[model samples]
Target: MSTKPSLAVVERLYLADAMGAPLQARLRLSLCAGQGIVGDRHAGRRDWPGQNLTLVEAEEIENYCLSRSRPIDLALTRRNIVTRGVRLNSLVGRRFRIGDCLLYGIERCEPCRNLGQRLADETFDVPAVIHYWTGRGGLRADVLSDGAIRAGDKLEIVDTSGGLA
Candidate 1:
């Protein structure tokens, strides 16, 4: 039997030096165990729940953009990782790996007014975007292992079952 786990692909990686700074796309992200994504705004931050990392589905963002007749600038999505072909919310409470980094999914990242304000511009309004992204926002995860996670890396749920001899 194959030991491979259910997998998902990391589509894009984003990082920012500080809060309110525009996020920059990166080819790889350095994850610090028990910390956060290196060089990211939330790195070393422990105050926020599930603040180690954030992930969202690219498909959901695309759908939202399509519905609003506006193109997406994924960086504005505010997620540290943009993934495809997986349901992030379902991974909550499960352990997973992306490249060499192991992580624990913590909770659903609920849309907040901060994100609403960020999405608002002359092109769109804040409240509408906030409500529109309700359940489709993203997932919050805790970094469990230190490693480099790159764009295009496969995300696999780690198996906890001890293998039988």
Candidate 2:
């Protein structure tokens, strides 16, 4: 894999009151270390560690649409940040910065039945949703610093080691 610091821009930001709830688009969001997006349903919930934030690439959605012959809503994915130009999968176990906030990629945010259930009404093939997003769902991250992130913010890979880690 290439060690070059991957660069991307935040394309969209979303938040919701609770799990499985419709997402609300935001131009900006406040995040805290050890907590998720401030005011988000999962914020401060320790039950699921490393779930402080979730990210999905816009390209993934495009690819899914092309492969499935249907369009999927970004909000339905339940990811906090929708990015463009960054390979989120490669960031797993790495540290990255979005705006002023620092985040550590914890794991792949694999698609789950819950996501399928949420799209049940709008989609006729829920399994397809799961299938398409299985490994491309996105990445789960833990906030390392408190700060504000906004749409159009640039993403930068942080060098944790003396060189790329």
Q: What TM-score would each prediction reach against the true structure?
A: 0.88, 0.85
Q: Give the TM-score of candidate 1.
A: 0.88
Error of 1 at 78 (Å): 1.1
- What is candidate 1's lDDT per residue for 65-133, written digit by digit as tens? 777777786665889999998888788878889999999888888799998997777767888878888
Q: Over all chains combined, what TM-score does candidate 2 have?
A: 0.85
Instruction: Note the Cα lDDT for every prediction shown.
Output: 0.86, 0.84
Question: C-alpha displacement of 79 in model 1, angstroms?
Answer: 0.7
Clashing pairs in 2: none
Using TM-score as the measure, the top candidate is 1
Counting clashing residue pairs in each candidate, in order, gives 0, 0
lDDT of 1: 0.86
